[model samples]
Target: MYLGRKAIPLISALALSASAFAAQAETDLKFALDWRYEGPAAGFLLAEDMGFFAEEGLNVTIDTGTGSVNTIPRVASGLYDMGFGDMNSLIKFLDADPAQPVTGVAMVYDKPTFAIVGRKSLGITEDPKSVEGKTLGAPPPDGAFAQWPIFQEVAGIDTSTVTVESIGFPVREPMLANGDVDGVFGFAFSVILNLKAQGTPEEDIVNILMADHGLELYGNAILANETFAAENPEAVTGFLRAVIKGFAAAIEDPAAGAAAVVARDATLDPAVEEERLQMAIDMNINTPWAQENGMGGIDAARLDASFEALKAPMGLTGAVGPADVFDSSFLPAAEERMLP
Candidate 1:
């Protein structure tokens, strides 16, 4: 059926309007993750796969990062609009140069995943003191290593007593497993599972979470460039809202979350990634504080205490408060952030 001359122009107008609507419906946003596609990263993919980001009018591109420490500079330099990175690193970065325009908008890991994993045969234990005089393998760019100074301050352990061996992330676990290093500093879930996969018995490895050992630091958080946030506040809010929904859904069904991760990188072992997702939830995301206060919101007192605890150890040039490090104004309503 051919349209009349007048009708043809009306149809063309409608088509143009539809195209414009589609173009205006989504905002393109680039997101950087603290690490590669792994168990914890499944939530972001699930959000994208489930259309949560699309529903929020966001076109997000999630990319892998070198480490939590590197994530801060990437976002601060405007290389990415937003990212997931270590909050402690962000604080130190800001302390050194308060001019940097970056802040954490959402706290994902309620408890820091930082830990010191070692073999019991090497005389390492739950106590932080066991690491003294030991050759600890640590990746230079690792967030855990960046926070090791603060950990030493809180635990009263002398840094000079421990021999620091800089190792790359790939060989961190292998070195620990093969006895090349007495211990390694890393994320609790990542290092523990890697060691177990390398044929190390779970009973032989000692897992010491920095939080339990008196380091009251938060973990990887949703970071945003202050310029982008100030220019497009709605985009930041939408991004975080989608993220909360993604994590809540992932937390309810970790295997499903692992499926999302596997979809992004098919090479990842489904079983390993699934277990890794669950461990991250049980050990990091679902902390008592998050359970009581809901996810993504940081406790003010804890944040302040963390700033104080790490300030001296980090050697800041000036004073910086929690407000300087994190901005919670972009958070969704507490009720909307509750996890199932």
Candidate 2:
């Protein structure tokens, strides 16, 4: 059965039609990240670039977000199908309005990154109490600053003499570096590395991680609109499956992950981004608990304790519970989510 010229063109047409139909069959998902296309976002970006999402029958469109807390309303308002956001903020959001259609589906940062980054030259140190009587810069919408009340209460830091200046995000690090402020509230990875980039000596920097102190709150997570999730449960599961692969790839080769990020934004320094990526992996992503229990799920007992801790500072109405904010049904098997 030798193919003739006429049959060749007809076969090509059929192949093209089949390709178009397959593309149309995929589910379109809009995902919003908590921040810019930085080193931390490598997993998501790499998943898209490596065709992991496509393999999962998903057409994912990821956009950089303004703030972690701000991502809550974006998903709840049906503006996006899913988002990466702070879990503590999500808990507060759900507590305020139990009717919101968004909740966290997968835990990304098992240990919160919230921290008070200070400079030793400016009279700050590793002790949580060292912040007493010092000027601290806090961005109005920062996720870390939102947890200050909790940190203060848990760490028993005397804030009576501490000065908090409401500053913008762009100036938070600059003020700290210039000695205008003693410390700034931000993610440990972001602030510590940014300070180094600004020529601040690494030896002079001190990071007071809230998690290392007494804050039991979880960090950023993958949030899904409940309506979208119920409508497309398979898509949600598939998305998580792909995301697990992405994270595993990132853990295995951080340089490749950094390259994925640099591919998106050419203005970013590759070496700096690589270091940032490694820090996130070491400090946030691949924690001992995550390594032991696998990723993308939470410990119920810890989450309950976190809810209790947040009750006073966040002024909870006792409306939302651990079950209300996190739904782990969409995650892959425990073995599948294991780190490399």
Candidate 3:
């Protein structure tokens, strides 16, 4: 059917109005990342850049976070619709106040990044016992440092002899590099890479990952404000679906993922960010369990055991359980979540 010349302007005006309405219909979501725009953050960045969120009818705005431990409160306060943060921290937060309006929906880091990083030259070794009688720097707000008590208990470290210095995040790595501290508590990837950037040899760094030493806790996850999730369940699921595609893209091409990160923060080195992204993908995101079961899921038995492990250190009142803290119902289908 052909429109007359007089009807052309009316049709164009109607089309413009429909376009505006469709744009307005998108669900607006504000996401908070646990850390800066680095290699690990490429998934979210790539998803946003690739328009996956747009395809899902979501307008997501992601912001850098200060710390994983701090991200929980940001979401709980309704300051952010969703966030990526430490699941152990979330567990502790929920235990303290079950009514808090936040819960983990997707398990991002299948293996916890919590670790005690030290220099081999400083008498620290791969053995957990090596940290004994050593002074370690710990950032108070760090998620890995928050797990120190639990790591100490599980790893059989004698805290009586180990001295922990409360240090700022900016100074933690520098103190270690300058030999001001024998070791430091941080995410293995972040600490190790930062140390390397500080002129420390890779071979001299010893990363004592808590997960390898019997700490069964999970790591950073996608957290949603309970109120927001309840009111917009479809939006939550759609956001996660877009996130899965982003991760898949990142995993398929790490260099591209790093490029996405560099695009956000030009001060970052492409090579370093690429390596960091690969480290996260290899050690955290693409674990054997995640490879088999797909991403963004948790095992009930493991989560229960983690709650048991966190009981004493976290001072959990038994007010919340694994079910209360994590809701896998919001995750997309297993096939869709599978990584490359």
Candidate 4:
């Protein structure tokens, strides 16, 4: 599930000069993606096709991420200018390497995409909470899977009888269909859509939105190594502005966006991409900040809530603060026109 592109050296000390990036053309802007062609990636794909990055003078290259967790170190070491990752991964980076310096430029999902899907053959949705004794599928005991026990504790999912497997997305559907696994807990934007596309009919799956069970996580953020953001704040802002337009376009016409994505098979998807694009649109378009302010507006309280929520079991009680996690200096102004 790797959608790779030509590798370019990350901009380590890149300071965008007016004469260099200008108001129009910034070439060679490299952004590493968190995963293959997951739905959360639509905005980046849209930006690429519609010439948003080009309009900003960015000759953009988006590479698929090996794992979201590894993005920060690569960015800090100059392997990538920016990378897409979750906030928890960002916090983990600060814990290990405070100097690895990176800040989120823009976020993708306003709320957690985490969910659990059960084999419809079992009539699990007849009573979704019946998942207590089930053996679930997750991405190993990493950050995402480890959260399950945490979720069980708060949601009363009953950990004593539950089991989690970490084989990755490709195996989820087959494992469940064959009864080798009972459920999958991960992003609906990716896993569920992939399941349906793989012939697991909508009626054959029972998706448990973790948010309903008290697990709220924020995923999909565009992050840059601090050195790059610090030197090229304007460029980062322009890039964000362009990407926001990309998201806006994706929401307005997901089918069209899917068409655009398929054009780049290296970073493409048909149903999964389109479905998630619309989902993000529906969720993000109505967020308190996105509503009152506009796109890409980060409300302090929203961020605070997110930080407070993940702090406990993530064991980052006194770890990093808002100042360390995100830097709004490069965020686009809500008044700015988005890529339509």
Candidate 5:
């Protein structure tokens, strides 16, 4: 008697388990992106465009969030199963509600891309406190900027003289270029490139790399609530494995990945996508760390530094610890299936 297709394949299951085979049987996942379908988030676009999630039996819908910080509460409230967010904001959400725990599974950018840009002619230097006398543009006067006082104190800049302007994400560069504000807090990789693209003179800006000034934090992480991760560790691990694989592929060929991003969102301009994708590659996806440890590993000490930076800002200086912030189990499991 001839064995059926299923039985025939089973006979050739060299070192593979039935459970492992079943694991790929059409699992649905809800993933939230750090931003809309654009430049900083190009790795995720490549992941979705290249069918990485589909291969893992995941039906993932990439949603564009209005703000970088909103992705956190969305996960805690069960609005999403997983979200892409920064380390600083993620810690705040997790600390506030231990009842609904969330964990960081992967790191998208090995270093912080966050920074502030000022008018170059001022000769005020890249000091954080120097902006105290000038109008400063950042996320908001509330969220992270309020904590700028702490950062300013640490950096030895006098923020007391700084006038804070709460600019949404879009206005940061334009506001500075048009002389609407003296400086703006933004991602140096994106905002600075954009200003140049839009004909903003190179001489008009002096950038203070936030990371260099000691306000370091990781960006674009994969996070899920503890309940879901606990209930389905394998699924979470598999999804992250696919995410890392997709990012690796994207880094190897950003042009192809950028094209993939364009194919997914036809409304997007190719020139914009290409520029954005290249920026993502340089800043996040293909960093030096990814070359060594793969795309998703975390340095615990750096992570701790981020938590420490945010604690005083969020008014949780003594309320939280690193133990409550990150969970590495999912990332390690994902790393196992990858090529070293």
Candidate 6:
């Protein structure tokens, strides 16, 4: 009886210790986003506000980023544990330095938003061949600009004929609006909306989505530091789960998504951001493939073909395979990732 009584107390003490440990064991994760707190970024914030990350035992901090290309280096340098970045940019970074400790853990945009937007009033035509004499404004760090070589190859545009003008992201739309440049390259939703904000009429702006042209590139993805991913695999999986939940929530209620963004930065115009979020959902995030395969998943054969197409344009030194860039082991089941 004395032995039994002693064992019971020990067991009770062990349970208490386990509970205490679990309470203190939340994994702190710092996430870097590709741009400002725009409408598209609402999913991550919504996931945090909705307690999705918390449910996974993760304490996540989301920070706005400068650009997609910059996120690759930021994650590789361990400045952030995970980030929202472009898949094409990630591939280029890996080709440059295969030794970098970063890989995409989940697919975000099923349809890449990369596009060549121009003012039709300036005589820019939707036909890729029409870019011959026009000056195209492109930012060095823009994902669409980074994919130009592939666009040039697919669209059959002669780089020699096109006047390529280097520009900054902040003033890209302004330049196009004022006729300073004939065309600009960026995400279609971003460029289109910004141009409208600058008083450019919706009909005058021409949006040419790259996916519709010839480039079969995947868009932004959730990237994780390889070392951190290897060390805390469950945390990586948990993070993906949270992100999937966030995307699902955003898909269900765009207003809620914009609210999540406003919750982070009150200075933003909620109406505009709400429309932006909806456009991102309609144009980039939600696609036929996403509807069929569910979110956070990729078609392996398509991904392989995409890498092959990017090789010549990107001028990859050594061979960097698609497997090296994307690791899908962390994604949740398709049913769990499906949009509502």
Per-prediction backbone clash count: 0, 0, 0, 6, 3, 0
Residue pairs in steric clash, candidate 6? none
Per-residue lDDT of model 5, residues 1-340, tens digit only: 8888889666767437666766667666777876656655656666677777777677777787755567777776778878887667667666776666677777776766666777776534676766768887777522244346556756877666777777777766777777788877766666677667656787766767766777666765778877777877877877887777776666667676667667767876667766777776776566677666777777789777777676665676456677776777777553443422
- lDDT string for model 2 (231-274, tens) is 99999999998988898898898899999999989999988888
Which candidate tops TM-score?
A: 3
lDDT of each: 0.91, 0.92, 0.93, 0.68, 0.69, 0.89
In candidate 1, which residue pairs get closer than 3 Å at backbone N, Cα or C atoms, i.e. clash?
A: none
Q: Give model 2's TM-score versus the native structure.
A: 0.95
Q: Can you tell me which runs of candidate 5 are displaced by over 4 Å?
A: 1-25, 121-125, 141-149, 264-267, 332-340
**Candidate 2 displacement at residue 117 in angstroms:** 0.3
lDDT at position 179, candidate 4: 72
Ranking by TM-score: 3, 1, 2, 6, 4, 5
TM-score against native, each model: 0.96, 0.95, 0.97, 0.83, 0.83, 0.92
Tens-digit per-residue lDDT, 1-71, candidate 4: 54344322223224444445564554466788766655556778888888888888677788877556667
Over all chains combined, what TM-score does candidate 3 have? 0.97
Model 3, 27-73: lDDT tens digits are 99999999889999999999999999999999999999999999999
lDDT of 1 by residue, 112-131 (tens): 89999999999898899989
Better of 5 and 6 by lDDT: 6
TM-score, prediction 4 = 0.83
How high is the lDDT of residue 327 in model 2?
98
Better of 2 and 4 by TM-score: 2
Ranking by lDDT: 3, 2, 1, 6, 5, 4
CA shift of 187, model 5, Å: 2.1
Q: Cα deviation in Å at residue 13, candidate 5?
A: 27
